[model samples]
Target: MISLPEDQPRRISEGERDAGVRRLQEAYAEGHLSHEEMDGLLQQALTAATHGQLARALASLPAEDAGTTSAIGAVSGRILRRGVWRVPRVLKVESALGRVQLDLSRAVFEHPVVDIELHLGTGRAKITVPRDAVVDIEGLRAGWKDTLYRPRRGAGSGGPTIRISGAMGMGRLKVRHARR
Candidate 1:
């Protein structure tokens, strides 16, 4: 039994349990855990009654994936990533005649610095980051409109640093703070 500090147990919601299960699945797919280990963890996650128990079940897993990932938006399509998704160390986003939105407000970042390489072609791309994160936009070529807004204080030293680069042809790229 997991011990709680205040003796008052906090109920674990279904969403939280599902998220834990997804993380375990990802770990298993990435070869980070064996099939037996994943089965055990999934059982614990499904039966976890309290927040503390759920946290204990997921405590041994890594915060994010071990390597980089790429998300592509093809022509006339949309690609969106939000909610409690994991942010990779290096993310490559490409959109051609489509829209792409990456919201990192509720994301989990394992790396201190996240590099995003964008390749937009006649499409719109928006990246919404946390207020505390440091955003650096560079190497934006011509024919692209930049609507990135930053705070006066800049990113905190301890916060994650997001470095955005690459080219956008006749496209719009915007980066702003998350509302929440």
Candidate 2:
């Protein structure tokens, strides 16, 4: 990082922001960020609404060599309207020394927003939006697990909303939710 002298103002470049994103993404992926924390940070980067935010994400993620990552999710109104969804749609349902089952599903919304519901059982779930579209989501998980969902507010006004329900061993649902 470069600091500005008292006599002058400091200047930041787009490269620096990219560096931040790299760092952030790596940290989160590497298990450094709890699900909730990761979701919050990801939302911040997506909701940046400016080059500064995008740059920050690029810079925060682990520094990668040139030709590293193809744009995973860049904001685009067109994709939002299309309501297309790709990989990382997983939900776990059980957790214990024995076994568990979690179900994950999706439905076309009246709008672009994408919602998510996760019934966590025995793993870490991951997904990314390939386009910059509205994102809306609510997740419920169970059994000594954490279910976190964070989307750029207003981004997924009508995108997608996910719900999860299940139990951990002893037959008690740890997480449950249903949207009318």
Candidates in order: C-alpha RMSD to true structure: 13.6, 19.2
Give lDDT tens digits, candidate 1, residues 1-180. 977777788785454565577778878898888889898888999899998899888888887554676565576688899999888888888777888889998999876668888888887888888867777676555375765566535444345677788888887888887765
- Supply the TM-score for candidate 1: 0.58
Tens digit of per-residue lDDT, candidate 2, span 1-180: 665576343343233333344456668878767777767777666555555565554554554433211122222111111124342333232223232222212332232222333333344433333222332232343445443434443332223333233332222232222122
Task: List candidate 1 segments past 4 Å from native.
Answer: 1-66, 152-154
Look at candidate 1 and tell me the lDDT of residue 155. 45
Q: Give all candidates' CA lDDT scores.
A: 0.76, 0.37
Write down the lDDT that model 2 would get. Answer: 0.37
lDDT of 2 at 92: 31
Model 1: lowest-lDDT 10 consecutive positions: 150-159
- lDDT, model 2, position 29: 79
The prediction achieving the highest TM-score against the true structure is 1
TM-score list, all predictions: 0.58, 0.25
